[model samples]
Target: MSNDFFSTSNRIKSTPFTSRNNMAGVKKYSVYNNTLIPTVFRSLKSDYFHLIKHVQIWDVCCQKVIEVRGNNALSLMKYLFCRDFSKIVSGKSYYAPIVNFEGGLLNDPVVFCVEKDHFLISLSDSDLFNWVSAINHTKEFYADVNETDILTIAIQGPKSEKLISKIFGEEIKFLKYFNFKKFFFNKESLIISKTGFSKQSGYEILLTNPNNGILLWDLIMEKGKEFNIKVGCPNMIERVENNLLSYGNEMTNKDTPYDCGLGKFCNLETEYEYIGKSSLLKQKQVGFEKDIFKIHFNYEFDDQPIFFNNLPVFKKGIEIGKATSIVWSPKYSKYIGFLIASKKIMNNLNDYYILDKGKFEVSEIL
Candidate 1:
C-alpha cells in the first residue's frame, strides 16, 4: 500500500509471505535489490485480485536478471542444463526449468537468447543466482557469470498489448511469444519480451539502467491512461486456471522435474555433459513416480478458512499428502487447487476428500 515500497533502490521489507526466526525475528527470505514491492498473499487475494485482472505496472526488479556472457557462455550453460542451447538462436526467449543432479527442479527461470554467445537468465527468486555461482566454483565450465540486480517491470493484462504498442510503436506487435527485441527510449537501450504471468497478452520489459526505471514506469502510466491501467501483481486465480506453475508452490528442489510435469523441458538427447544427466536418465528409465492432479472442493465455505487446506489429508487414517496452491475462481465460482500426493492416492481421486473448514468432495480432475 505504500508508494515508497516501489522506490528504485535496494531495501528489504518483511511482509506476510516472509517468515521471521524466533529469537532474532530475522526474515527468512529478503526481497533482493529492495526496490521491488513485496505484495503479500492475503493482500493480493483480497484487495488486488480483481484489480490485476485489468492492466497494471509492477516493479519486479527483485525478480532479478543474471547475465552470463563471454566466449564460453554457451559451452558453460550446456554443462548446467539438460537442454541443448547450441541451437538457441539470438532474439529468442525460452521457459526452461533448471534441474539438479537427480533431475529435481531447482528453479524455473526464463532463458533469454540475447545472442549466440550471450544469455540472460531471469530469476523468480534469489536462489538461481546462488546456484549459478555454485556451479561456477567447481570450474566445471568456462564462462563469465555475473549477477546483476537489473530492473524488470511487468506490464500485464488485456490492454497491455495496446499500451506497449503505443510506446514502442507497432513494431512490438510483431514480436511473437517468448521473443525479445531491443528498443530505445530517450536513447537508452531496453529489452522488451512478449512474456508475462497473465493468460492475457503482455510484456516483461528489462531495463539495463536502473536510473531509467521510474522514467519508463512514468511513460507507461501516461500512455496507459486510456487503457485503464492499474498497477498490480500477477493474481493466483488467473495463473492457476492457466496451469502456470508458481516457483515455491507447485514444485521445488525436493521434487524432480518429471514429478512436476516439466519433463518436456529436459532435453536428454543433448550431447553436452550436464550436472545430473545420468541420475535423471536412470530415474526416467526405471520409471519414477507421477502425481500430477487437480483437486476441487464439493461445497464452498468461508473465504478465509477455505482459501487453504489446513488439515491433513488421510486415507484410512493414514496421512498421504497436503494441498499446495488454492484459489477461488471468480470466473468459475469454484474453489480449485493443485495438490501433490502419492501416485496411489492421486489415481483414486474420487475417494480423496479435501478438508477445508468443512469437508468438500473432489468434484473434478485436471
Candidate 2:
C-alpha cells in the first residue's frame, strides 16, 4: 500500500466518531465536505467481504445538511433541481440531484420533508450551502436556508436490521426503503432513516446531541458484537462493482444529470420551472456526447487500482473519454470501473482502451 497525506486542522474538521475510528485502527480516509471521513477500517478486500456478509458502522457525519424552511421553501426547491418534488409523500427520503443554470450537476443530496414548508437536504460532498443561501437571498421566496448541525452515522450490511433492532426495537425494521421516522433510544430521539451509501440493507442515524455521540457508538458496538459488527466506511470495491456512483467522482460540475446516467431522475415533460430545465431540455433534444458505463478489463491487474482522477480512455490511439473510477474487485477478480465514453464509441464499448493496449467489456447498468 502507498502512503498518502491527510492533514487535519481548524478548517478540516473531525467527526464526533474520529477517536473511535482511530481506536479501530482505520487504514485510510477521504475528506468530504471539509471533514474527515473514514474510507477503510481494516482492509479493502476484507472490508468489502465483511460489508456484503455482516454489518458495519460508518462515520458519515461528513454528510452536511442544509435546512430550507418557510412558506416558499417549496418554490425554492422547485427552482433548485429537475426532480419533481410537487408530489412528495410523507415519511419518504428523496434522492435529489441539484444542478446549476447550465444544467450541470452541482450536488446530489437526499432530501427529507420535515414538514410542508420545512425540508432537510442531506448533501453529498459539496459546498451547496452558499448556492442555496445566495439564491434565496433575493427575497423572491420567503424561505430560510441555513447549514444545520446534524451528525450522522451509518450501519450497513445484510445483518444491519438485526443489529439495529437490538436497540431501536423491531418496529424500525419495517420502515420502507428511502423512508425515515423518529425513534427513541433511551432519552435521546434519533432520526433513523432506512437509507445508506452502500448497496446493502442499512440505516443512517442522525444524532442531534453531540454529547450522545460516543455513548450511542458504544451502545451499538456492544449490542452489535453478536452480529459481528466492525468499524467500516464506504468501500470503493463494493461501490464500483454495484455501480453506485459517488458525487465528485462519477459526476462533476462539468457534466449534467443526463450525462452521468441520471436522466430518469429528471422530469422535463413536467411544467415545473426548475433552474436548468431549459438547458436539460435542449440537451435532451439535441443529444449528449457521452454517458457513464459499467465496464471490466480483459487483463487481470496484480495490485489494487487506486485512481485519484479520471484516467483518459482511448480508442485506436485516439482519446475517446475517461475512466472516472477504477478498483480491483476481489470478488470479480478483475478491474471493474465506470467509464464516460464519447457518442462515437459509446455504443461500441468493445473498442475502448485505457492504456492503449487492452479492450473494455462495457455493459448497461440497469
lDDT of 2 by residue, 1-366 (tens): 112446557888887798888889888887899988888777788899999999999999999989899989988987887899888766788898889989989998999886778888999989999889888876477598989889999999999999998888889878889999988766888788999999898999987787797889999899999999999999888888888899998888888888878888889877768888998888888897678777666454554345325566666777776776777777776667787656657666455355434444433222
In angstroms, the error of model 2 at 124 is: 0.9
Task: Give Cα distance to truth, residue 174, candidate 1, Å.
Answer: 0.3
lDDT of every predicted structure (CA atoms) = 0.69, 0.82
Q: Give the candidate number with the greatest lDDT.
A: 2
TM-score of each: 0.86, 0.93
Error of 2 at 248 (Å): 0.8
- Across residues 20-133, which tens digit of lDDT does each residue of candidate 1 receive? 111112211224434333344334454345445467775566666789988878877777776677688899998887888777777788889898788898876537777887
**True lDDT of residue 298, candidate 1:** 50
Clashing pairs in 2: none
Query: C-alpha displacement of 358 in model 1, angstroms?
Result: 6.2
Off by over 4 Å in 1: 1-36, 40-53, 300-306, 309-311, 356-358
Give the runs in model 2 whose Cα sits over 4 Å from its true position.
1-5, 300-309, 352-366
Lowest lDDT sum, 10 consecutive residues, model 2, at 357-366
In terms of TM-score, which candidate is strongest? 2
Prediction 1 TM-score vs. true: 0.86
Query: Residue 83 deviation, candidate 2, in Å?
Result: 0.6
